[model samples]
Target: MPRRHLHVTGAAEAPLRAALRALRTELAVPDAFPLQVLVEAEHAAKAPRLPSYDATDLPLFTIDPPTSTDLDQAMHLSRRPGSGSASGAGPGGYRVRYAIADVAAFVTPGSALDAEAHRRVSTLYFPDGKVPLHPACLSEGAASLLPAHTCPAVLWTLDLDADGRTESVDVRRALVRSRAKLNYAGVQKEIDAGTAEEPLALLKEIGQLRERLEVERGGISLTIPEQEITEHADGETGGGTYELTYRAPLPADGWNAQISLLTGMAAADLMLAHGNGVLRTLPAAPDGAVGRLRRTAEALRIDWPHHVSYARLIRSLDPHDPRHAAFLQECTTLLRGAHYTPFRDGDLPTITTHSAVAAPYTHCTAPLRRLVDRYASEICLAAVAGTPTPDWVLAAFDTLPDEMTEGGRRAGRVERECVDLVEAALLRDRVGEVFEGFVVDVEDVEDVEDANEDQPVTGTVQLESPAVVGRVTGTPGTPLPLGERLRVRLTQSEPGAAKVRFVPVVPVDPVDPA
Candidate 1:
């Protein structure tokens, strides 16, 4: 999925904030945790424990958005000689040390904090703010993997071969301190300028190697440019105005993601080996779906050779192209029916693989931001150490799927509605103006009240300017060609109702072949 952000200026912030609040109410998101939960959070902030290992000396660092405060995982990647006799006796390999915030340590089992977390399931984010699962005192303060702050963490040490294949895994609770807080753009700049320091210098090499391994394992990664709405002061009008642009992912972002992916795969392996734990599962795409996508590609004029895999073919696409963007949008049909599967008491999950990763995977990396990661981390730690899985975690395993699913759907609704509101607001004053756009999707509209009994055609169009996508009425006789560029005139835009509509403006000359 592509990332999105809405930056509203002071003038436009009030209405957007109100919409977000209304969305929270409509979604039934828990506004606040119970009083008892807050008390527990206060107490947990002061409690301390000694871990078996003090890894504060490790030159670990966190990379995230500049505004992020609830840091979850910090990492240090290096190449070193293998140790010991059984497994670590070879030449130097990659050593990946990932430190995940120990959220379980702060939220006690069967307590109000735990119960509230279960209710919330995951953090719900919006343009203005987020409704966090854990109290700020812990998630943003105590349990966060902040720089120069020694915090308890569930540390994962992965020993990988030269080709980035996992050779061994170790998980344990430890004390860690992040040396620095890094952001993607800055790190990418440093890397491009050849000024990247230790722990980040090897990121590209290791990340590319792991990417190769992923491709070899039949994994797929989509890299679509994200569309974001940013508000800025209008010099002429002296008021706030919004602008939309595409934000491409940096190389550092991909490299950092591989670290988290490595940890999740390791966590899944531990749980699956023990025949107990939660797995993020996605069935392989059906052959029919792939065939449909191939047809879509053909319609969009994208060459799909028989020799190339879908993953590789898609990766080769230029996201900036309208046809490529339409094809990528169509590819979403292939990645459907993802769900969490939990197994226990020697019972094996019928489905264990996450199709995107081409491996058994689970969530255990972002405990500070996600509720499931906390439970998954506890399960992985217990499974790796040959200790019994915590009773509370086991009890919640069966119900987590439902909770997470509901929360995910609600979050999706909130995101879509917010985007709709922004798009509507941006175009409300421009009704009847012509704009260039490409048809991305087509649909047939049936109206029984029509005396002529003729069905109307409608579809979605991605406008060239403003980067807005909205529904558009198509030509009556001719079906709108998907991925074809055209001129459209806005017919309706209601900011308060979060609605926008357009109508095709047929050209006087023949339409160019798409």
Candidate 2:
């Protein structure tokens, strides 16, 4: 799904903030870092001398959202002559230099800062604000790879063949500076207008090449548009409300992601070869999963030819179509049981591959915002330098998996609940009105205790307007088929419970085959 942004105005703003605060309390998230941690951060920011190599002359730049402050990574991509090519100056391949914030360099192994970071695991973001994993003094200040400032970074230098395959990798700590701060929309505009320069200009060509390689490796990319809720206020009426909208990711986003993916793949290779590191792993989708999706496509009247690959078939669908939306939702069943696995001393990990990436992968970027990335970066640095891994990082491997898993579950619940609350608030005043929606998912009533007591079936419906998806009741006599478009009347909406319910208003007619 695409990213969702929520905006609320006037009267609705206060309540939404209050609700988010309560949700934070319910989730037991720390509102602020410990005082000792803040003091440590301040000291680290003030101290200048540290063990780092200087590479500040490189012209690097950062690309992210316009309002983003916790900048983590910067890049500089350029072409160079290949090893065996005829002309030394001719285009042989590409050299990519990616710099990531060196949070580990500032944080002592057993200090309060490290302990607090371990507890938080990752940053939890909300529409109004975010609960940061590290104090702002470092995450957004000294350790951040902001433009024009020399900062410590875990620099990754990768050499790729013309086809975008990795030829060599190097990881080191260096003092680097960014030339400019760029945003996705701005870079994309330049790309479309054919005026993009240097690194941004090379993104499209390299991104396409890497994407083709991904397909050849049997990797799947889900390009679903994300639905977002935002708030707005009216000065004339002295009123405020929330609005929902969809945000489709730009091509620049994919190009930037490929760089991150490339670095992670290199990190995985380093760790696996040395036999001591953590990996992000997922099992291959079961055989029966594809068969079930084919059946779903058949019932939805969508074509799924026997010869088509799953990845190709999904890429061919129009995301705006109701059938495609429902199909994409169903595809989630294939990607389950994703988790982190750790190995040591040349002991091969039982699960080494992330099925989604179709390659061995790990998390080594974004140390400013993620806990495991710090450890992963340290391990990679040691592996590349041919030195013994740090004892502290090795000791941390035993506990990080459980901490990260629990924190991830809590963060996911908070995000989903916040969206549900805002959606209910947006629809509360419109009860008893009919709207057009498509049945995205359905379930047979197992018992009478479900939401629809009298109706034999209950299901989820995605509305055309308001961009809301909620539960709806279907008549026992007329079953609601998946992907069927129908009219529904809003029956109830409770913002406090983050609940919404609807009932089918009329039967859906089958499409004519003229």
Candidate 3:
């Protein structure tokens, strides 16, 4: 649920892009695909392995950000023939057919492209651009599930009962085409206007039902507002300026996400049945964490009745509200412990479930971008086909977990650094200015040997405008007031160090040294 989408405009765009390029070098992740990998990808794009079964006429369509080129999934939704009766006939079910890009079909084991994917692990999306897992020739070309473009894929057919519970699943390699490529805003607009067709309307209906099912299953999904940078062009100066803002996610975003979650759950179920595969796991939150959150709600002055569960409480809050945003930010603590767990040959890990999902889950949805999904797809295929999981894939069980962990670490490093750099840049010119913000998180600096009991502690402050979150502290021996709006003066803004600091404003300015 932690998300950041970057945007650049004006003079800052060039400098930010340059800084990002430098940061990529510092992180040791190259900006372009390796020559050998690109060559292999190109060859694979033109003449590679293909699937036998074809389902191009299923009227499947893709939904993604308008700029997404390495499209990974396409789906077709429809009502199952019958289910409302005792004999199991009439409105009792829905069928969701999802198509995922078949990256494994093109990247042969031990090939240059395959090795490169293992090294990259996953696509690294930065503020300006992305370091893709595979070359464009493969990721954005032949293998991409572009609209009207047939591609090799793993097609998943999920049959769900009236309550949106998946009753059965079928998955296999197939050649499929996405009839149309749609964006969330457009589809949502149609839905809101009551002009949506069956496919689009069904997304809302089933997405809502699946959501209800999730709550019943005790799942948690944080609709964390996305922090984004936007640029506004200056007319007279012929330049642009940047502003960081928090954009609440649209309902369509969650609806589409539920479908992917459904697929991951199905994949996890398949692997567990066969006693093999990697699970996206998370240890359940400690019992006291909920107590802490209730306290957080109290601090933020939001009512939390004793009988209402955290999931329900979360759904009840409107993220656009500052107090609710602060609460949601606090809620991320419950899911911070998630990780990938792998096992094989009936050797299941002790923690087989993802706490946030409250269900067994795997990452099998986005094969084009994630290395693990390619492997998970292979496992799920073998599990369903009654064939042995590929030798290469089985062997990867040893290192894939570490590989994914390292990959995620690198991505996080880049993201944190990118934000630090941009936030510093945005505040550099106003280092001595004060901004209004609310404290969303607080961390107690341990009572050290020389420190006092009431020593000032650090906390995160969400700025009311420009939407930046930075460190804020109080005067010595005074912790920053939590969950309350206060004017914090920007005391330090060092772009080179990618650091920024703020402190509660003094009522009166100090005497000028000059």
Candidate 4:
């Protein structure tokens, strides 16, 4: 019998549709709040004070996606002999000056904008559009690091050694104007072609230096291909799925590493110098992740060094190969959770702090989009200015560990709901059909254990395609390794319940033998 495409209808809607909609509505604040009242209170509390701007003459430029509007940062570079080195100011040690828009300049304390910003906490990124923090007048205009417009900014001047490690960090208030606004793809092309412009040339140089620094410092990084959906004008997918694979090339990775190295260095300096502040995303290492990966390697006949960093292996895995895809899925078990913490004058506790960055770092980038960044940036500012951290910022630090976590949970729910809706809608008609699948799990319907030994009493396995995890009924055979492949017939799929069940189609001989 010819298999027809499943056309599953929702119970009027996906189960999570209502829940997601409710959460979004609950979390979303009006785009703009009346500032007259807040502004008056702000002015009454403190007179307008602005940071010094001095880079207007230099052609600082911003390169972001074409659709990007909340431009938060701009950059320019100048090369000279390392102050004392004899490189003669030509292709010598370079200075990377990143001009971050001084958002604190406009959003004064105890004002309407500040209150609204606090309430919203962070910008929400949705598939269709984004919910911005400040209005366009500021986030996209005055406070934006737009091209050719001199703007007030908090400048970070990093002195790099021949390697990318910062010899010193010079933070100051400056006035700067950008030369051009470019995007990642364009800059990538320019780098690849080797015909680099003013900014691209600097980016290439710094990026190379940073890459070497990371490798030397025992850092592990991965280049995963992310898939994005785009509009397809012709065919069955006129509005179908299109996957976007981004090669985080040397240039991009280098650029990112430079930023990470700088931020991590800065964060370390601050934490050492000051007694207290909040650090972002520190998850305790997942227990038994290594053992599980070792088992996975043995089962799949893949050679992974037991002592080698998992991140390094992931980076080397070929994205184009089928085994790599399956291996990537298996590796997901080893990836641990992340967290935010408040620290006082004490030894830097050994914790899982940004495994990807391989550094003790905090969220200080993208303040407009991340709530923690805004708060952390303020902490950086206060520490830099040598003033007591503001009461509000301190309060935020205390409350954030919960609020942000809750916010993230809500965001995850919404995203998962959307994905489920799309997948259920796609698989509506394919009931009872058997498909080749990887065995991600074989556990009891209750008491599922995690890497940390915490038992999540649920019979579930996460799948790749439709990309979901749900409860399963039968407990296949023992010694069934997680992430093993098998043929399973989709017995039933309940869109309303957001449920999917699979029955193992027993094979004459074990299909996936090591």
Candidate 5:
């Protein structure tokens, strides 16, 4: 790849320059309210305590991404094959327990820390860094499930069969001390090499069970590839490196599957027991997905099965090939918006369990990074301990949906803005340069029912194919189908707009379509 720098000598009257500077300043100091005072207030406020168990004896471990520090849950899975448990292939089967961190114990309700946590509500992931929900001193240290540090946790012991069905479950509050901290890549490598450690063996077994369950259920999802941008030393007078990376399925997805299954099972149990609670939600695939997918499949010349598993299809696609970019882009349309809302007396007729996990799920893994998890953990703690639920915790149940929904939106906006800024910056210096690109997606215009008669038209774009969407410019009136070859001229480049619109160039002697 040819390396080039995009300079930011803004045009004489570019409004973007001012906007970019203002955004830069905002990014400089992430808005984190002071939390120490709240921490003190929480400690001082008297509250009912749930009886604690000395589970520090049971060994636990946490596995996560390399850069993750706000550790939430931990696990230790053991098999009881001949111990009278079902073979685990059918319902009423028997499997050992999977434990998670009980965050509520450390963070008392109504504390300053709790208040600050509610305000932040979730973690903000910027390319440069993150704005943590809890202070590192606590999230990564005191409250974290770091090995050898005894911490209170909400533990779920699920009994399952060979087919990955949960027969029975037990939730409780226990004091735990993790045995080790493993990263996803390293553990995955170990699993791939067939050199399994004790923990990896258990993790593998649990992952297999979860995978089986997900495939059986109608949980459809896509394995979208993400690009990582780093400052390359020689690129811009010694800045960083920008590289596109993909995660292998094993241990990365496997590890996530284990945690998600654990959390989902726990969430389901809580919701079932309470008769009502706010659920983490995502709607089913959109209405036009099937037709759009058929068109995309035709564009790529890939067969679409009469019965399709979105996750299975995605697993078959290659992210390294630019050809797959457009396909993945096309898949984005199928994802419904994720939201949170409260439900009383099992009012939610249509449960919006996560589509990826194929089960009832909630945000309970990373309390230190998300506001909702803290309260959810508390609910689980109270229910498991059979203790009277705390007043503040109950109140959190009612308000968490609104806070979490808002937090999610904020996080998405911040992430998109950051990516736009960087991509725009990268393209600012490449104005007027021509590059070969692909036609990754295309859409048809449509009208919608409008309440206001003044404006009754709304046009939506659909993805044409599963290929890389690229910008081309030079000439007009040329047809560019998915997977078609094209060269384009870059007329205008606006980093702020993240805009690199191009016009298709036509050859002197064009081949007619058959």
Candidate 6:
């Protein structure tokens, strides 16, 4: 589940834009903020409840998409000398200084902003734009870790061994200023060219070590290209246009993510040690979803040995390969099992780990965009301080699971609809043309999920040219092959409804009578 970015290239965009607007209206997605919320945000922006400690001299830097403004987390990476103690710096290990935006400092508990954040639960992202969780005055201004701006942050100091095993951790409130706001491509360019500063260079080293550590721990961090929408202008061409394409995942993206993952794991360990906190958990992917992924891999012509775990297969993939990219996109289904779960009084949930992470994890990062992170960050801060978890946070935990679950559902719908709208728009004129596709899914394992009263036939087909997946219908009782190449014709491409359909092109019989 990768987030999509929108850029400007050129295509007729009115219809798709109108459809997206309609979808937003239909979903009753929150639009402009109420007057009171905006007023409170602006007031809080000028006078935030600043933390006592100051660490702006740490020279932390942030990594995000270049256009990002709601900066949440920043970090400074360096090595610690050996102390010889098991819990001390493990023989010239590393230290990660992570600064997370202290959203709680601005949004007081039980205030309008807090209530609105709880209502929204999380930010909703679409290719066109994103519905932010907080007003821009704070999320993008006072609370953001934008370069040259001192912001209140929950700074984490994590000590790791030479092989990337965490040795110790410390978390506290501090004021931080990011030295630079960097992007993946820029960082990668610097690292590859041997011009990266010590911290940037250390990122490549530690990120690779963390990746190896992740695989050994049974994690599956997939590298999937995000669908990008950009508009192109001719300078004289006034008509609005757009283009949709996938941006291949870069090594820098993975490296940056590993640092975030490292912090989350550290947060989880802290919460578990304290015996009170909420965790971002995921149950194991269902059999059906895994089977679908297997079919997708075969369709991509990638061999999957029966004994090779999907995690291993995913790790072996070269994400730049278009076939691998398609298969990775299909992994969104595998990630559907994720959710937030709260625990307290030394009671942990039955499933405390994310299946994909293969370890206990918590969302203590990205508070500017995610609701749970704020809550989780508060718990960690109070925990390290040896204070009781806030009463309000404990009260909110009762409903955090349900609220975040609903938020995730809305996000999933938005991602799916946007992809569907783009696919339909791109294929609208290609109806009736036969295209090669792979049968990546059957209707359902036990029965046809889209069965009509008269006939039962439907499955998902993946088209290669444009990376479109649609319902592939066939004659009565003829279940689509699970993993076979087939000829399919686009039958319906309605951008307005975000609908697309395909039918298998049944080969005609020749010379029937002898």
Work out the TM-score per prediction: 0.92, 0.92, 0.93, 0.75, 0.78, 0.89
lDDT of 4 by residue, 401-505 (tens): 776676566555545544444444345567777666555444433334342324322233434454434444443332333445555667666444454666566
Candidate 6 lDDT, 93-202, residue by residue in tens = 78899999999999999999888998887788765677899999998899999999998999999888788888888999999989899998999999999999988899
Candidates 1 and 5 compared: the better one by lDDT is: 1
Cα lDDT, model 4, residue 441: 44
Model 5: lDDT of residue 390 = 58
- The TM-score obtained by model 4 is 0.75
Off by over 4 Å in 3: 9-13, 85-90, 233-239, 445-454, 507-514
Cα misplacement distance, residue 287 of candidate 2 (Å): 3.1
lDDT of 6: 0.82
Identify the leading candidate in terms of TM-score: 3
Q: Identify the candidate with maximal lDDT.
A: 3
Candidate 3 per-residue C-alpha lDDT over 1-514 given as tens digits, one digit per residue, 9 for 90 to 100: 1278876555544555567677888899856777888888888898868888979889998999887889999999988766553445447789999999999889999888888899999888876668888898888899999987988999999998877888889999999988999998998998899998988789998999889889989898788888887656676664456788898989998999999999999999999998888899999889888778787788788999898888889989888998898899789889877788888888889999998899999999998889999999999999999888899998888888899999988988888888887888778779889888888877745425556756766788888887899998777666666777778889887555647898888642222323
Which 10 residues in a row give candidate 2 its minimum summed lDDT?
82-91
- Backbone clashes counted, model 3: 3
C-alpha RMSD of candidate 1: 3.4
Residue-level lDDT of model 2, residues 99-190, one tens digit each, is 99888878988999889898888888766677888899888889888888888899999988777778899999899999999998899999
The lDDT for every candidate, in the order shown, is: 0.81, 0.81, 0.84, 0.57, 0.57, 0.82
lDDT string for model 5 (1-514, tens) is: 0011112332333444454555646655346557675455345223323336777777777777666666787777655454333453332334545556555656667777677778777767655456677666666766678888876667777766554556666777777788888887787777777886765665776667666566667554454455444433343333332332332234456545655656665675676577555567666766577577777777766666868666777757765555565577577666647666555554663765765556667766666677776666666666665665557766766677777877776766666565455554445566666555555554332323433434322211111221112343222233345554444445555555554455554461222323
Model 4: CA > 4 A from native: 1-49, 82-91, 231-254, 281-287, 325-337, 344-356, 382-392, 426-475, 478-514
TM-score (C-alpha, index-matched) for candidate 2: 0.92
